[model samples]
Target chain A: MADAVSTPQEIETELRKVLSYLTGNADLIHADANKPFKELGIDSMMAIEIMAALEKELKIQLQERDLAKFTSIKETVETLLTYVR
Target chain B: MQALKLNKHEILKHVPHRPPFLFIDRVVDLRPGKSIQALFYLDPAADYFQGHFPNHHVMPGSLMLEALAQATCVLFDITYPSKRKRRFYAGSVKARFLKVVQPGCELELNSKVISMVSKGGVYDVWASINGMDVLRGEMGCMCVYE
Candidate 1:
């Protein structure tokens, strides 16, 4: 099995990769990690896409409830760290 | 996938979803406990299209998955008739929508039962239009006995 996300830095890097791809690089530089995803132009569809991509790359399956709880990059990384295996 | 066969009336006997919500239109071919090929004719008149996108209308990916789930339920119904009344709740889904399905497109959906638990099952599902894959994924559902 693959190692789970163990550190905040690791989680942020992973999130950045996903967010960059979903929101496009033009907006990535201006994105505030603490702001809600909506402010960063990440819609529900993009959020789902990011989750799918992360699940595949991380080899981890996240629950639907977990998806509902993380609305910002900071919250997402924090939540991911809690479940990082 | 074969031509048209089982109609919505027949499918309704198995699944609980109704008009405007039921995404399945017909069952092309099905092998009990094995696999199923179904169809959904995306009607522009459907309510979802009215708001899904005002300008560029496209069927929701989540609903497409629901269509697959309904088809899986039909397979389970034929495979395990005794458990027909059990409500199968989608437990998890790992899906990717490769193409945007628009109104008036006929969706060809196919699914195969990959695993079965005492009260649930997992299905490998794919959806296509004109022989091009639009979506594919793995979905699991658990049975809730009433």
Candidate 2:
């Protein structure tokens, strides 16, 4: 297993920055770190926008079935950490 | 309340876009990894129209590119955020036009995922109206982050 993360807080910190960036780059939607995209209202197109921005901004390769797990903010952040380290 | 109707307002819930830039007005359906049908109305008063063809208006190819990008972005927003967020964007896009997207013409964009990679994905998209292929292209995108 990967190094155990101390808490979900570490994951949220990374997510907050990513989500904030998503809100800026994507012209289709608005969201904060605390706000889950599903709650803030995100569909496939919007999801695709944020995903593109995140890929550009984060510099990570998350393609194919990798997308299946990162369907939500919490899951995305967790997944991001997986490839990052 | 017709069963097969979606307005811009409803679309907003799924996409992260505001006015002037957002292209796809509504999505008729999203069948997971298969295809997507989106609606857009050709407006003579659109911001880009003034410059694209002062005398004869035509939707520029760049806007179509952005539309594809925007629509795909919105798709990821609803389908996979936290994971794909770190992995979504167009690496390549090629389009061909058989006819013009004139004012008042209702446009429909139909796209299907062709292949997915470790870094990005490719989609085969066809833009049509009245069951005619007006524009067609293959879009390739990726997610690069750390």
Highest DockQ among the candidates is held by which one?
2
lDDT value for candidate 2?
Answer: 0.63
lDDT of 1 by residue, A1-85 (tens): 2356568887777778778865666566446889998887775545555665667656677665666656998898877876774
DockQ of 1: 0.03
Q: Individual DockQ of the candidates?
A: 0.03, 0.06
Query: Where is model 1 more than 4 Å wrong at Cα?
Result: A1-85, B1-5
| Model 1 residue B61 CA deviation in Å | 0.6
Candidate 1 structure quality by residue, lDDT tens digits, B25-126: 899898876789999999998889989999889999989999998888887776666643567777667898899899998999898876543355667899
In candidate 1 the C-alpha lDDT for residue B5 amounts to: 55
Superposed on all Cα atoms, the candidates' RMSDs to the truth, in angstroms, are 9.7, 12.9
Tell me the tens digit of each residue's lDDT in model 2 across B1-146: 22233578877765556788889888886655456678888788897888888898888877776677666655545544444235445656778878877777877877776644344456777788888988888776655555
lDDT digits (tens) for residues A1-85 of candidate 2: 1234334565455455555554453522234544556665553444554455455545555664656665666677676677666
